[model samples]
Target: MKKKKMDDQHFDKTIKGRLENFEGPDFDPTALADLRYRLASITTAPWYARYRTELIVISALLFFTLFNVLWQSQVEVNREQSFIQVMDSLKTSQRIIIDLQQRLSALRRITSDSSNASSKPMTPMAEGKLNEVDNLLSQLLEEKGNNDPSVIALLGQVSEFLRSEPGMNGDQSPPATPLSLLPSATYHFPLPASSDSARISLDQVTLKENGGTAEAKEKHLTAAMARELKKHFQKGVGIRLGPAASLSAITYSPGPRVPSVGGGLMSDWILSPSLSMETGIIYAPRFYDREGSTMMELQNLPGVDESLGSLKEVDITSQVVQFPLNLKLYVPLSRRTEGVLGGGYSFLLYLRQDLEYGYQFNDDFDGRFQGLKSTYEQAKPRFYPGTLNLSAGTSTLLKNDARLEFSLYYQYGLGDSGLEQVKANSFGLRTAYWFTIR
Candidate 1:
């Protein structure tokens, strides 16, 4: 035990001497400070350098999307404003034309009353005033052209008056030509004279049928002449036939965007000097070629995977019939050409549709499949009932009473049409040839 104690004491001294000779690693605050500085520098680096490529691409995409949206919005707003301005201008022009027409009618009534009066012959002063008025009218006709209905009517009345004047026939003797032989150019003639002076004037005029008094006979002759003149003007009706091409789209909704081409027949009638009516029938057919890759899954087959799919191609065709009734305003642009503005209602008579789908299989189990096809037909009150249309065009009168007309028209469907919730909005070009009926 005493020797073990001496050895343990010697080992303890040896371990203590070794611990005194051994030097541990020196602690430095600067090392910890250097590490913290490096970490902070990395965090404080420029944002662009940290996320350069990703940020650039995201910013570019966002800018492009924003620019596109703003440009499209600006274009739509400008278009709407322009359309409104045009409609307002049209309304104003129409009002001015109507006012001018009323003024012309009043002037014609005054002149007719003076001419039909059975007073003493026109004095030299009065005749000179009439001559000045006539000269002024001729100058206006030369400047404004013969297309003005008011001018034409006034000229016709002047010519009729010259023929009817008692002593203007270059013969002292009573005129041999009857009043019926003169063309009636006025729309409304002076009523038969009620006073004694009017009766005496009527007595001076002779008619073929003398059964009634001079006044009655004169009235009958005037009536016949008016009817004949009306018939002559009404004969200017025209029949038009043409081909039309249209590009149709849906607005305020989603639909198939397609163009339709067709032909039509129409009849135009002159209701008045400046107003006309047209009725027509149009048949248009549209074709849609839509092809895309679609994955269609197959099921319910033994030894076949449920995940099997195929690609498909879709195609559709449709047809529509339209009937239009329109009123056109004629604004003479020249002797042979006129500008036309019109609006009307259109009836969608019928619609026929066809769809075809073809499938190409990707899996060997199914291979290629046969196509599927379908057809449908719809008529008025079931699909589209009617639409409103606006048109602007020009017509040029050609030789032999034929006319060439070219127009651009826009149509807006009043309600939904077809099997889907779709309405037709279209703009079209129409060219027509019309032959006047004699």
Candidate 2:
């Protein structure tokens, strides 16, 4: 036991002597460079890497919004195309009806002249038949009631043509001359063999007989025309709904121009072709960073030099929300685009505020001035009328009749931002796409 203790004591003394005699490794200048390189790699990470989650969320939202707009546009395109087709068919039918009327009128004049030339001007029944045909023709040509005429009015005139004609030889073909209504062609009607002069017709023409099909087509065309006329002449109010985004910054000389990004919904009431009134709620998350120097006085304090007021830098950051009302006018730029001019009012609602006060000479205070930050959770006057905004922009009409708009705007603060001498003015660029609700 005595021998073991002596050996342990000798071991401890040997270790102490070795420590006193040992020299540390020589200093390497490359160590400072390696430390600096490590710090730079950590601090200079790519912006996208730092905000990858935020960027993904934003991208997903944008994709959803775009998909919705495209779906709505496709629906409108289909409806508008169908409407155009109906209008075209109605126009063609109108032209055909007018042509038929003109031809009937010419035939009537020819028969009248032929009757006057014949040796018999007698028969009151024949004259009455001619007058009946004339009345039916007039009804068919009347503007307001033209499309509303019944099958009887249309086919009855053809029957009237058959009956009202003067007695004719069976072998004769009437009127070989081209009618002005159909300037491209001439029509000849054969007088059928009949013993009775009052009645003339024993087959050959199918149009007068197939009244049902003709009536159906006429009814369809008439309905379409009516709908087209209503859409064209009716005075109706319209609304437009859309999403908008803005890159905004507050206007102040002392404040650093920290960019603010926000998006929100907007709606416009189209009062006329050229004018609109707009209103909407916007979730505008804005960051305001202001940094400047202010005079600070430090009177006699322990371990502090007494001096006059010295310049000290301070920084503040505020977050705000805005709501706006606008009136706008549109001027035609092209077949599918318009130029916009607008003015508006906005109400600002401050949500939170943060301030950092730094002492310029506080390094001498043994790190006491570090981490000097104040955060205010309560908003002072919750909401106030904020700014008067002026805007200019252009809107392009999409295939679905919706519009894509790009704008530049300036907002002049109507009130202060609760920061001393700092107004809440801002300027920004905005983009929106709107669809009309009729």
Candidate 3:
């Protein structure tokens, strides 16, 4: 029992001696207090304070989405209203043409009866009424070229009656009234002869006035209406080619700028005089530069303690294509020039990538040395697949139904570039040559 007690006391003395020789970790009391204060403040902070940046970004996106949808709906409504107005105008013009035809028919009937009863002596009152009808018919025919089918039929009937009249049997010609006095250039129907047996052919009915044929006048009017309608609607296809400059690295990283070239085919639709939409596929050849180094520990020989750290350099290059849809608002600056503001979305289509890795030792302490290098080429999946863009530009009308446009634009990537924490942003100039159809 006494020996057990002595051994326990000796163990206690050895533990105390070791404690006296040990050293505790270096620490600052003030730093500990500060850390505790910071933790407590974070716990008591509002939720919005913790996620303020995320909340702002989400709110901005929601507002932009809502505004775009409402604007498109309103534009559609306006387009419908404009179409209705044009159709109404055409209907009203058709009704007026029908009324004119009815008046022409009634005059033709009365004149035909008068010519047939010419063998009977005419009283002064009857002759006056006939003259008045002839004057009204002449005025209606001269005001405009009546191409209505009903008017043409009535004219044919009048010509037949004049040819069959009994008064035309002798050398005595018809009375010198307005209808008989019409110039050859003013009438599209054959005139009656002094003899009943005299015949007239349909080919002799063509009217020419001021060196312009009836057919020519009709064509002119049709062309005028087409031009007027084109002022309200336009559609076209265009080809665009331009130089582009872009950020070659991930967003927030130092840009290694590179030159790029692009070209595309686009379809454009003008919803109104001032609003339009465009969509197309673009083939853009893009390039990126990445220069980085990594540190790795190296052993001079197998199972040896002596070692050195090595540095590795990595470089990468890529090429891609893009598809975009855009909306544009136009403000007329002159008869042939306009200022435009636009916004849109795009999708990326990746093609190929080249990666190179090179490594070397920091110091050549050992006589033996090693150099390692590798290169790989691969087809890439769709990378940085989505982007949003904004643009401002001007367009100038050119000859032969063509236009020239110039714009400056900024694009913001909405997805990663197939790499962690990497996005894209770019600014560029675009020029397009467009052909318009209406």
Candidate 4:
């Protein structure tokens, strides 16, 4: 505000300075005679002279108030922008911390091998295995670039842990169970030692669609054969899902739109900001004349609402419930920010997908029509149980660490007709708040 005031004052001075700098012609024309006549005629008004000072004071006060209000608005706008920027940075920092934590956890989870020890009185092979272990230790304690002393120190601790773990020929007992669930990361030796051998394998999924055009000779799936061969070696494995998921949420595709006027109209009416309520059923049976169901949604029927106007019935209402399988990726954008993009497909319903199932259909009588006549057939929930996103957000803190965000996204239904695809744009806001990440 202080800077704004100073700027305004400087701008006013600059404007007046330019006006004062003008030098007029050194000739007096007939303009002075006309001015004299105008001055002689202006003395008739009396209210102007009495209220002149009061009007000047009032005008100055109004200007000051307007100037202050505008300045405050600008400040708020700047704060919001800065918050958004800081959010990106915070997201990036969060990603780095996560990567570091994962690395630390992997080091902690590593198991030792007692069978690899030299059984034959420390032969050349045993020496080679020891050399390999030494190399691994060097890698574990190596400095991370030039900075990040904590990460380097953590690596050193991991090296000490590895050294403490049992070696070959020591006859130490092995872990009761092996790590069979998580994917094991491998480190390259570059040049393998004389006695020790290393092998790697994938444990998760076998791909069916992962084929390059070049791999497919004359439209034949050559990559399929390659995958089949690779399965024996297990270079890349399929992923496994746990009985309990790590994260889950609800999201939808782009749905129908409501046009508004005068004030907040269509969006407020159809796409409810509040939880939707169903009155028996709100669809007409004939609307489903195309496919899938027999009975329609009933609204304002014999035992329904007193009003039969906008309240109508559908032919039938059918909902397809499904739990989604998601493939998620966290992309680091900068120092403290990250971009989240994930996609998946599933027709299996989980208990958590209740709201997602409800989201496929909606009906509002009082919410849509008020004083005007309009068409209602176009807004019915006809198709559902398609693909949808559970959560998608971009969290970032460009360089700063202060930003918060809120968003609203939804779709009325996923229609099957050709024309319905064009209506797939819905409401969502990308917002941000400000804060620092620890």
TM-score of 1: 0.40
Question: What TM-score goes with each of the models?
Answer: 0.40, 0.53, 0.42, 0.21
Output the better candidate (2/3) by TM-score: 2
Cα lDDT tens digits, model 3, 1-438, are 999999999999999999999999889899899999998888566868834543554465446445544544454334335644653543333323333333334334344545544354544544554454455455545532455343455556546644764442332223334333233322222111212111222232322333211221111123223333444343443233222223222332333555555555565666665677877666555455443422122112122222322434445555566778889898777656789899999888766655555555444567665656565566656556578979898988653335678888787888666322246777778876554433
A best-first ranking of the candidates according to their lDDT comes to: 2, 1, 3, 4
- Candidate 2 lDDT by residue in tens digits, 270-331: 77667889887665654544334322221121222223123243445555567889999987
lDDT of 3: 0.51
Expressed as tens digits, the lDDT of each residue in 386-408 for candidate 1 is 78989999988664345788888
Query: Whole-model lDDT, candidate 2?
Result: 0.58
Model 4: number of backbone collisions: 55
TM-score of 4: 0.21
| Residue-pair clashes per candidate | 0, 0, 0, 55
* Candidate 3 backbone overlaps, count: 0
Score candidate 4 by lDDT.
0.32
Model 2 CA deviation exceeding 4 Å by range: 1-67, 70-78, 97-236, 253-258, 293-311, 363-381
lDDT of 2 at 407: 96
